[model samples]
Target chain A: MLPNLVVAQAHDSVMWDYTRKMFLGDALYQFDDRIRVSLPEFAEDSMQVPVSVDASAIDESIVKMITWADYNPIQHIFTYHPEPGMLPQVSITFKVQQSTPVRAAVLTESGQWLVGSGYVSAAGGGCTLPSESRMNDDWQSSLGQIRAGRFSSTDQPGADRYKFRIMHPMDSGLVANIPSFYLEQVELRSANGDLQVRLELSPAVSENPSISFDLLSSDQNYQLWVRDNDGNEFQRAL
Target chain B: MAMNSNEHFEGVAMVFKHLRYALMGLVFCGSWVQANPLDYALTPKEIAPNTWVVTGLTEDFTTQNGGNIVNTAFIVTQEGVLVLDTGPSKRYGEALRQVISEVTEQPIARVYNSHHHPDHFLGNQAFADVDIYALATTIDLIKSRGEAYTENMYRMVGDWMRGTDVLLPNQIQTSGQEIIGGHSLRFMAFSGHSGAQADLVILDETTGVLFAFDLVFYDRALTTPDTPGLMQWLEDIEALSLLDFKTLVPGHGEVTSSTKPLEQMREYLKWLDQVLTDSAAQGLVATEVMRVGIPERFSSVALAAQELQRTVSHLYPNYEDAFFAESF
Candidate 1:
């Protein structure tokens, strides 16, 4: 039984090796469990599923994090760079094609790769479906607009919850003739110019990406800076 | 996934059937014990000689109330009855049917859905046998988004949505007049409150009663999650106010004989649009706009603060884009 268990472990490593080769190329790293991925057990709407990744347990050693859906046709989702004074946590909404395993691989300054995974069961065709914003004629006129606000948490004192949304089509390349145009990075900063949270996004993120997170500070002043892949930058103070 | 009928013996089938019946009995008993009568009981008030309306609570959807927060009306004529809008759930529809029966023995000939809002059309499941009519856009949106809305209602109001299913309106309505039940009912489709679907306004030529669903919210604050433009909504109100009507039944508020509701709606929407536009012109983000002080006049409006906060999120982006374009 002990030998069989060892063989099974080897098989699992072999599968991870193939996946890593497909995504990360020839990068060498170690798997750590400090990173965590959270998603709904069953996706109520395949077009918009809430997803969050928390690497707070890893402290300040993390430099970048990459996430993907293992079964999606376009497996690459996004890559994040946590700046100084930023928490290693992110929340974003996404669109999944079907029931698939979602993985978040975090890379630390020490060259360690911590992987966390979650399964989201979807009915199907979130990618193939036409954009919901297509119904509106002036969707392009409102692109890159951001709405940001913070509310004090009633359940947890001293925790201010920040919620914001950016108006973007987030068109997936899979859609016919709708080139991949999405917000690539977002940075939330305090009044003192300290980075609070940073997010890297992709086309998989739903149109008008809405996100919420908790800030441990009581300061009411903050600013949001966002830049899409097309080099359109927007910044606003809250 | 095909079932193998020959694999299971007669003995397994007998035991399983008995077990299933026992489970079903327990389920029925549990639901009966938990059911509350007040949650489903909605009384209809007669605003006109033959028109009756069931005004829903002004509060938001909750697990206890089960999202019974919209107005549903019916008109009885010489031939049969015509329902304006269905309530929020299957149970509400059934209760409404009982109330209609109590009022008159006339059969429900046709049902008209005001828009694609789940609160307006989910009750179509109860009157599936009748011809449910709506605008073409409303029908299309309901067909695509009905299931998601039903799922959301279940999550919101819990068991109040039990046995509730998505029912699409089968008939399409255009901007015209129809003589139904010996009354000249004029129907108009206009866009405002809901961006995806147009609102339905029906006017009975006999009583001059206008069924303005979601187009005019009297005392309560209007929902803007699907509102494409406040300007468009204001224009729609202007158009509606011009019509000659004796009584107006809004989608969510109380019925009124005067044009006070239309005036109040126009005032609120105009003020809201001004606030958002000015805030955007100053380059204030959504959070800053949400913090702006509400005018003294709007302070009395129900959910004014809450709806303003939501409206900023929905419309500030377009305002900001307009501001940006102007600056350049």
Candidate 2:
């Protein structure tokens, strides 16, 4: 049996169990500590809550990683597939409606799931109201704009941090008159045209999606490509 | 007892009518107290010659306090009363104005917003007719982020934030010495508090009082959501301590005559920086970092644990990025 790093309470959360059954469909899973989910204890702004999920500690070979919020109106946050030989770690921002448990489920190559959990308390109302970008008359003009950069860590000589932000309102369609609009696909590729990772984002993401990834240092430049649900494509080189 | 039917019916009807009236009176008095707790209960204490400060409670925002957690003051000058900052909501601003009037007959001549934080400037709606002044960058920040802050305030404080709207300052204030009436004032701008380009700090050379806005929090823990960096904030505190002022009015907490507030701020900032750095070096996650023990010296500081948690949330990632990325 796998080490029971996380208590049964995490798996026993009524909402989490329901969500797991509904989404994972009785897949073999266990609450494991190797998968770590980090979030604020109290979300200062319900609109933008930072979340980091790292599955690099797991000794098993990973297949894919999926994350969700148990209480979010749109529970699915993202599903990330790290390309072969890439580390399974990502940081992103999302909207939370209220206090909820956020879980990151990592699927290992052995056909088992390892889950990490964290709880965040919020002041509520993250998805009900329309985003600021939706209200701007000129929001369309700046749509699909991308600001991205990669920083080399001075302490970790062989590590690089990639941070990027895309200008698109990830409207959850919960608000009246605003349809569900969000980045549906994101791809990171090396200069030599090698795929690094691919991410599927849900409307649970905050407006103007910003994401960060930690990877090994490389001399080659990288390009990020994003596609929204509306079929609009945004690309930038970092 | 002979013809009791009609008389008995009339008496019962009269009793019911009187009961209804009494219930209505009780409701009127109850709601008069409940719905009207918007009163800020502002009392201006004269700190210096013609200078008065209206201090707020050193607590977090709540419906009960109505977001009255900032210090706003006014200088009754020879020309007119120069207001420092408007309080949190329009009601608080109106209360501040009324308190100012009670102290001196001088009309509000000029108004200055210390920064773009909602608590410091949301009250701008009350002083709509006055020419409010702030740094050009501050005005821009208010325009960009003020609405979101207003929304968050409404969520945090509920009904207390009603009628509060974002009102942009009309005039631009720069760093310089200006003589208003008989008081010579020096306006300085710093960016350690709010990540916005600047935070306004004012010094009354004539009165020897420094209005060190959000740059200095005395007994209360300083907020760090929009701060550029803790080291930068420490530099600002160091510079502020060098200012020649007899009376120091921090953005929060009580007014002081000694340099204890500055000393406390400096020591607290240094300690916070050390904690973040050490936690990062230890490869601790945000949750672990937040749970780290705070020093006993900070026991007297209000909301230290809460603010430390918030700071860890806001800044720990940068520290973690500096550490190892073991991909085992």
Candidate number of the best TM-score? 2
lDDT agreement with native, every candidate: 0.78, 0.85
Q: What is the Å distance of residue B31 in model 2 from its true position?
A: 6.1
lDDT of 1: 0.78
For residues B121-167, write the lDDT of model 2, one tens digit per residue: 98888788889999999999999999988998898888877788999
* Cα lDDT of model 1 by residue, B1-328, tens digit: 6547775576688899999999999999988877854467879999988999999877677887878889999999988889988888888888888899999999999999999888998888889899999999888888888898898788778788889998889999888988987899999988899774478889998889999999988778898877879999999999998899999999888899999899889999999889988765554445456657778876656777767766765676677566442211
User: Considering every candidate listed, which one attains the maximal lDDT?
Assistant: 2
Residue B166 displacement in candidate 2 (angstroms): 2.2
**Model 1 chain B worst lDDT run, 10 consecutive residues:** B319-328
Given candidate 1, what's the lDDT at residue B67?
85
Clash count, predicted structure 1: 0
Model 2 residue B242 CA deviation in Å = 1.4
